[model samples]
Target: MTIRVPVVERILSANDQLAVANRAQLDAAGVFSVNLMASPGAGKTSLITGTIQALQGELRIGAADGDLASSLDADRVAALGVPAVQINTGGTCHLDAAMFQGALSCLPLGQLDLLIVENVGNLVCPAAFQLGTHRSVLIASVPEGDDKPYKYPPMYRGVDALVLNKIDVLDAFDFDVDYFQRGVQALNPDLAFFPLSCKSGAGIEAWLEWLRAEVRAYKERRDVPGNSGTDH
Candidate 1:
């Protein structure tokens, strides 16, 4: 365990440097990106599909999906008329900055107004790697239980925003919204929270509005010299 510590540290440090370079590239192109992390079946693709369907006319969106295998997620996003890239992790649990940088090269970054990278489906490892996105959002579901925040504190603590998907089933499931939100509040007090259902479109408009505002704010900040705001 002790010997493995520094190796992990070195890997993450290298990833951080690559992430900085990735961010610089995105900033130069004036593109806003998001790193979306969630457990398997947490509706990461569904959320992406829904967002693209709703914002298709307004925003030029792109997606990069990371998975252990298969291009299904990428296909789903591409079918919506958005440019999609697939990053096969080849059995890796999460995506690193290097993989994201490569995907960026394949994408027309300057032509895109928004980019969302769907990280591999895991709660733990994705939180450790910095992918240089403007924001990192995590999706939790009604069926995933409210104890997730307590169990995966690092994932909850690291994200800039939280999305509670599958919310349309709240009445059928024995989930407590207050308990989940409170648990998240303990770890990240100022975390942006969005409770929406990709299936039913419940509360989706609010999420969309927030996204529009964020993009507008990011664009406004670009004109200010030496703006120190952390987009993530």
Candidate 2:
């Protein structure tokens, strides 16, 4: 007779265990990381590119870009002269902890101030697996509509911050900013929300300021963890 085992639990248990190790490694290296998640065409690459351009001086950055195939996104960021690791999930829905660990090994964590893990463009599976980052950011485009938070509560619930991209096109689309934010606030009361456009760069400054603050806070926390320091 075969004994039944909880496969999902086992997998998550293992992932969780490794995630702890990954976070510890990041802390030891004094690297603040953020896992960026979103659906396809949500401008994850564009956001990261803008970030690299804006923060390149003060922040020594690195990236691990995930995609189903090809190194397009990774190549896009690497052109900016930062170290970028390409993670091809090979049809996998998301980037798991193990996959992230492999990417981490390729990066020089000590030499960098920030590491951006661009997870596979999916709102679902990416939320379930933690990549041992300092924080997780979710990007929802205006074109994607305002019903995302209601439809993808798990995605909204798990992230530390929310970015509503493509604000420039809001006038063209039927996206309701208030409705979208209301849905998010219901799920994540204290969530950090930024409505910006990468196309025209209207609200990019605010988003960049938040990123700068998070990195500084993370480094401070690593040296002296506050009540909310652990996440950084």
lDDT of 2 by residue, 188-218 (tens): 9988899999999998998999999998887
Off by over 4 Å in 2: 1-5, 225-229
Q: Could you tally the backbone clashes for each prediction?
A: 0, 0
Tell how far residue 193 is off in model 1, in angstroms: 0.8
- Across 80-105, the per-residue lDDT of candidate 1 in tens digits comes to 88899999999899999999999999
TM-score of 1: 0.96
Model 2 clash pairs are none
- Local distance difference test, per candidate? 0.92, 0.91
For candidate 2, the TM-score is 0.94
Scored by TM-score, the top model is: 1
Worst 10-residue lDDT window for candidate 2 reads 223-232
